[model samples]
Target chain A: MSQAIDLDLLPEPTTNVAEYSVSEISGALKRTVEETFGHVRVRGEISGYRGPHSSGHAYFALKDDKARIDAVVWRTSFAKLAFRPEEGLEVVATGRLTTFPGSSKYQIVIEDLKPAGAGALMALLNERRVRLEAEGLFAAERKKPLPFLPQVIGIVTSPTGAVIRDICHRIADRFPLRLLVWPVRVQGDTCPAEVAAAIKGFNALEPGGAIPRPDLIIVARGGGSLEDLWGFNDEAVVRAAAGSLIPLISAVGHETDWTLIDHAADRRAPTPTGAAEMAVPVRAELHAALASLHARHGQSVTRRIDAERRHVTSLARALPSVDMLLALPRRRVDEAETGLGRALRLSLSENRRRFGEAASPLSPNALDGLVRDKRADLRHAEGVLGHALSRGLAAKRQRFDRASLSLQPRAMSARSDAHRQRLVDLGRRLPRAQRFGLERLRTGLDAQWRVALSLNPDNVLSRGYAILRRPGAGPDGQPITSASELPMGAEFVVQLADGLRGAVSTGTENAGAARTKRARRAAAHEATTPAKQGLLFE
Target chain B: MSDLNEPVLPPDDSDVKRMSFEEALAELERIVSQLERGDVPLDRSIRIYERGEKLKSHCDRLLTAAEDKVEKIKLNRAGKPTGTEPLDSA
Candidate 1:
């Protein structure tokens, strides 16, 4: 209790302790923070980054798991950032910390921003891809197909790097071509700018200028880590690649690594060498293909000519020779002459047989029986002919159908079919013509048979006419049938109604006279039928 | 198909020389197909085939005569491209 009373009685005269204003406190704290952390790297995920402010400053917070610190990048510093800071991206913020007097909050004004790790860098890359893709930068329709053969190839890569050399060597090995190498810093802060400018520069060149404009562009780089190859992901580089007038092939890294430029490029080669391979075809293979094509063209023409020649030769073969045409008609005339002699003998025999039948029977019943027999034979013949014609037609139709279905040449088959049709038509007409000829000959032979019966010697002898026989009158004569057969003064025997009588015939050369009475009947018969004899030698 | 007697004008040797590799090869292919199809008359076939021969030789020359080495872009002191220079010594 006494100590408390003593303390209460103590003087309140502490005057040396300095008091400061809020502004002064804030300024001192800012100064102290700057001095302590003037140059520091804070590795943390970026928070609340929404791009640059209208005033051209970036304000964001860098946060680790447990703590967060405000970060700001000035306009100039933002332009130089190794990569654009993205929200929730783990980055190493390098800057000094200064207090904002107005907010009474201390923040780090970031000088340079870099992705802290590969994982965070990939995340940032993916986010940027989503944004750029949404703008249709990587649309497939925007891509241009590379020319089959490019006369001039423009390459965007560092001249000093092995990537350019590898590309050149590969291109030379496959097919040599004009190459325009736009030497650029492949990686670093200035890399993206230089590469983009190189692409745009090539695009601006006039076509067929002193330097021929490139038909193709290759933006290539050797394989490297994400950070080393980060320049290819720059917006300028990707946009330039997407906007190239000529087709562009991006070979930024190994097969597994893909940069934003790869997406934007017309083609994405796995390596610089691969890009060169894609640019041109092998010269040797092309030469071989062209040579084969030329040879094939020659062979095809020869084949066509051969085919036409064969066609002409076959057509010539189809025409009948002149000898064949003449021989056919000449043979038919020979056949007709030989057939005429046989027809005369047959007609004589037929007339005798008919005469015998007529003398034996004139009954109506016999005539009816003969007619029935003839009709039955005709029916049988007609049935057989009908069957034969139908069968032949069926077979011919079948043959024609098969020929049509076969793969034989159409024109040749069609011509042969016409010939076959003509033969068939001629064959059909021949039998009908033969039947008409037979009917006419039968009517003529019946008339000749009646006249021959009238000239029979036995019938004439019974009519009080003696048949005269004379030596040397006929080659083998039993009787002299006409006065023209007797010589000038030959003795002849004449058979009268009683018996044989001796006679003498006298005929002068100037007179066509018959000395015997037998000559009268023979002469009258000749006068009545010069028509029957005419059939023999007409 | 056109008439067999109709004349087909063929590209001259000079035209083949001016044609690019793709153009020459395409024309050569077309000629081969025309002959192969037997659509062209003998006179026309021979003429176009001669043209194809010229095209083939021209493409071969294009392949053989390509610029062999790469050329580097030459920049001025201000870092602006002035022209180009051979990158390799040859």
Candidate 2:
């Protein structure tokens, strides 16, 4: 019966490759998950911890004091992580077990982690902070000043959130600084990797020459729980911040809030507002500075002007005019003028003397000739009368003697008188000689004297006619001898017969010829009119 | 009270620019201090007092001008500028 059963049984232990529909496979997986990974508390040290990446998925391990377990965290669960898990950290993970069929790997899918021992995890973090702070890692000296004018500020936070909006509004209100948003998780398990990546990306862009490098970076977010700001506290973020070439301002939370990033950054502002203030200078303050400088400059200029004015006033005092100072030079000039006038008078006298001496011979004979000619004519008349008289004289010698005596006295009296007597004698002898002849001769002489006197320029001059005697003469009253005589001007005398009444220059006369001609004319006038009594007899 | 109504002369550029803001203020204060001390020669003391008065006025004018500008800027944000006009001018 055993042989027959073995022959018939099992139908060759059917190796049908375990038939399964897609639905059945999933059902089995669900069943396995429900059965094996039912709510359990697993003790382990976390290792190869990947808290959160882009998809908000966390992958890590839960390790015991000796061993670790693989685990995964959905973004929803990771969003609530109180503390960050790291490799080699002992923890008790509470979660439902799950299996991944693709890799046939079992993971804890941890919902929660707590310190394996009794002490709180936060205490360890605080101690770590204290240790870092003790090393001067959080010192104020470790910080750098924010840029005055940030051209491009790198913002690292979630794209769709009030934090970014608040930061943006604050920055915009304060100053129109350029913003470069790099959306990354500010909290949750994925944040550390994303935050580190954002920092590195900005750094790499500079090395790659993708664009002009940002002047400064603003690692900013609104206020949050410590865990919410955990990514900034991450070791990766801290190292990246320390290593980055760009200066960074950590604007993590409200004024009261502080984070690990605050310590690691080049500068840590208490709030986003404080960060903005640190970044930009106030416009009002700058304007005030410029105004003050202008005022100071104006004041300095005024002082210099005042000093110059004082100098000018002092100089004015030094240069004042005084009567005593003016007296000496004025006296000297007056004395010189007196000397010049004396010299002019002396020179004029000498010129007159020289002119009179040179022109004496050219006289017109109106004075001496009248006397001498009349005397000679008288003598001839007397001689002829005497001859006639001698013949008759014998008879009346006495009478003749008496006549001679009377005549002798009369002969010396005047030739004109004697001529008139002879004429009377002739008239007696001829008895036909008329008084007309004698009268005519006398009238002729008187007429000649009148003509000569009229022709004398001095006659009219004596009657108050001013003779404008230019220094020279042509036939006209002008001083020019010829056209060529118009050379340097000559001095002229307008003589009034009395004295030199006026003087001028014929700017057109040759000075030498003009002077000589003037002297000759003046001399000719003097020669024609001898002085009345004395020179006429002499 | 007499000082309040008294006229003041402006400082020259050289005097103003020689000192920092704080130093200038301190010097102005020193001038006031000297005036308060009143231990100088009459002529010298008068000059010092005059200078102090001028400095006080200058400082006051400077602060007043600054305040005026600040007020104007704030007012400009709302509308137009208005205030007590400067003396002896349109």
Candidate 3:
């Protein structure tokens, strides 16, 4: 109240003095506020944190228990912040205090901002982790299997630290690989950006580029506190590791230390050395395995060859001998020849013996004996006829004398003369009859002699028919009618019209014998070529 | 499957060197199994065995020839590698 009364008592300014507009005064205020507090660091809980304006400026408010002040962070500075500013989160904002003339308001233009403490940072980290995890960035299925043997290994770490040395040494002990170190700050404000950039840079390398692309990546750092290791847990680094095309192994801090990178990477090693060990296998064990395989190969091949050889030997033993099969037909030929010879001899002798029996009854001596018996019969008949005639005449004379005495003497003498004449005629006729009988007998004898001459053996032989006989036979020996009756191993004679032929009986000469021999030869040939016979039979 | 009458050719070294350690090892194991099957011809078996030996030796050489090389990547103001320097292990 006193200040207001005093202002009222003081003299008003003269009209000659220059007057100022509201815009001018507001502009002057803005300049004074900006110049007075050029740069200030404010600690407050974020509230009403809103917009990135169209001019790339963020409008927000920083408040505490006593008061609240409006703030702005330019997009350029906001883009550089490692973490986002959210409502209800305490943060330390570093920037200039400036006044906006349009609203007649004063605000801090933030240049840099960070979480106020480790707890605040952790809260931000957990928020980010939850968001990213919800996005499936940390899904187990998203992980890739690390190559059993990587040709080139890209590393994201501080080149000046012992982490790289341990990794290199451990890899050398196991299996060596080409290491492409991408040096970066492992902690601090710049650490996340540098590490993320390194990972992205490795991923962008062309496979056939001048610098060989890495088959796998290892992001590693030595042990540190939560603040020191916060970079690995940063969203930029975790997203970069998760999005990498190559398989990644995260080896940050000690064995128990955990980072968001460990969750996002394809594999997590307890330490830097552990990552190296996982990359390759031991060399000596591989050599031993190869040797064992070589021995097994040799043994299997030898066993297979031996089995085949044994099979061939057994097959050879199952075949038959050649000589035994040939003798079956030879014996059959000899029996056939002997049968044929016996049949021929029986036919020839049967013909000769029949001829001899037929000729004996028709011999010329038989005809002569028949003629002599006829002549003797004729002489005895003549004597008996003469005696009967004389007796008849004497009885007739006595009867005639008695009858003549009673008859005339002239008739009696005439009868006697006639009787004497009749007797003479009878004697002449008897002689003629005997001559005719002898003529008939002589004609019959001549016909029998002609038949006997026609049936002679010598005459039959002269007509080109030959008789085959065994020669030099004794008187008791009849003509051989069968081969069985003929002597064995004897030479036989064949009589023809010209001369006699001597022939030895060759028992093996016959068609049957020849055929049997041919069959035997064929059987022998077949036995010798068992393979051919097997094909034929099959 | 290998043909019994196919001509056997010697193993080529440049070809073997181009293979990765895993590829080489896998090929070596394949050769051994093929030999164990005993269906391959003698000449082919011998040739494959020789190739297996070369692969084994190549793997051995890879392990023996390796030396740990530590290097520091040097970056410019824009964080691009300008060159490299030997890294101190200590």
Candidate 4:
């Protein structure tokens, strides 16, 4: 009976039991678990990373390139994080192991996590870039040129927000361009369609004949995360910008951020104000450029003018007048005058020779002498006539003297008787001798008259000087008779004389019978006496 | 010919001959792209920087003119624009 008491005292080979309460037991188990795996490192991709909220708790996942794990942290621990925890983040967590008894669940109470050094995010980005480049989406040739000075610019942004105002203010401040504001939601469900419509609206204004069809377009918004800037990344907005007729300049967010709109746009600016600055060139710079160009053009034009002037001067020098005038052969004025003088002298000599030849036959003195000789001959003829008349008178006187002597002897005997008879006869015819002598003188005068008449032109005509008679007055006014008188209708008669042809007209005497009578009478009278045919004598 | 060895081609600068603002900006972008691509040699990269310097100066001048305009607007806030204002003098 003592031996049985000794075995009981030896604790009967008892089970290992803990000497603590239920709460203490659980606490101790947790402490052991934590101590065994104190500050462990986990390698997994983050699936859900709820960032630190107002509750100061963060729940997130650590994900691989494909799979992920859940993660959580309290406020105190999360506050110490250098980087924000997020879903799809591959990270390594440093935490103590903990367990819950209610569901018997196990987890890590995360104290810290860091990027796993290499992330799938960077790989994904690179892959996308490569893909876009392969498709020539990012080709430099695809890029367009922007306007140097755009007057009207269209902007796509939220209607009532600081983004639109910020853009407008900056653009207005820089350059006072015509701004056509196209308001659209930058975020939320309607953002994609609204952004696309705004870009399309700007294009529609062009086709619809709107004033100042937006020279440049700027799609812009403030900085945000990938989700916030997703509107710009929409395929519609990107396509709209790419297809737009006008140049587009995108200014989506901060410099680090990029979007699809930026890639497809004609140009990209980091900020809204930066985009506005590119739209216009400065007035001052433009003025300088214009001045330089003007100077250059002026110089060129001046050079051309100078060249033309020189060419004209040379042409003037080459004219024909200069060469032709200087090249003529020489001649002397005095020599030419001498030659003319010699020609005049020869002409005078030739004229003198011709005059001597023509006048040699008749000397001036001989011509005067011949005229004097003819006058002397005429005087001789007149003197001979005078002598002959005187001789006749002398012969008659001698006859009278002889007859008187004879008569005187006879009268002496019968003187007494005849004296008485002669006295009586003397009384009857006083100076009968004087009377008879006067009678003889008269007879002598009559005979001389007959001789003179025979010597006259009329008597000469009777002696036979042929006379040409026309029927009428001719150019010489000669007489003409017969039907042939006035052959061409002229009128006159012709009288013949010794040395003269005298013309008489019977044309105006009378009519036809009277004219014939006058003509017959004239012919009869002309034929009456062959020796003397004068009417005065008749 | 010896004097022309440097090949001093005339600078293109005038209202008609000068490059447009957009052209200058596009060249600037090419320079940036060349630098980012890293495919260029170091010497080429330095050349690109030199080219970029000129473009930057041009951009700065443009910006300066804009700043002056801003200042002018602030000064002219009190009066209506009159026909007598000389635009050339401005």
Kindly list the per-residue Cα lDDT of model 3 for residues B1-90, writing each as its tens digit.
677654454346568888777777787777777777777866666677677778878767665665455565566889876655666632
Ranking by TM-score: 1, 3, 2, 4
- Highest DockQ: give the candidate number: 1
**TM-score winner between candidates 3 and 4:** 3
Ranking by DockQ: 1, 3, 2, 4
- Evaluated with lDDT, which candidate comes out highest? 1
True contacts kept of 3: 0.45
> What residue pairs are clashing in model 3?
none
| Model 2 stretches with alpha carbons more than 4 Å out | A1-33, A41-44, A47-84, A90-92, A98-107, A111-142, A200-212, A322-538, B1-90
**What tens digits encode model 1's per-residue C-alpha lDDT throughout B11-52?**
555667777789888988887888888877667677876787
- For every candidate in turn, the CA RMSD to the true structure comes to 48.9, 40.2, 47.2, 44.1
Query: By the DockQ metric, which is better: model 1 or model 3?
Result: 1
lDDT order of candidates, best first? 1, 3, 4, 2
Interface RMSD of each: 1.6, 16.9, 2.9, 14.6
TM-score of 3: 0.49
Shift of residue A198 alpha carbon in model 4, Å: 1.9
Better of 2 and 3 by DockQ: 3
lDDT of 4 by residue, A1-538 (tens): 4444555556544768657877777777777877897778888777655546679887765656675445678888776654445456556788877776554456777887665664444553446556655777656687778877665677777656676667667766655545666656687535766778777767766333523357788888888866567567665777787777788889898889898788878899888778777776545565565444334434434454566579899999888885576554324555677699889999999999999999897889999999999999999999999999999999999999998897776667776786788778778776787899999999999999987875665555665555555534433544333544533334334555533343444344246568788879988997885864446454
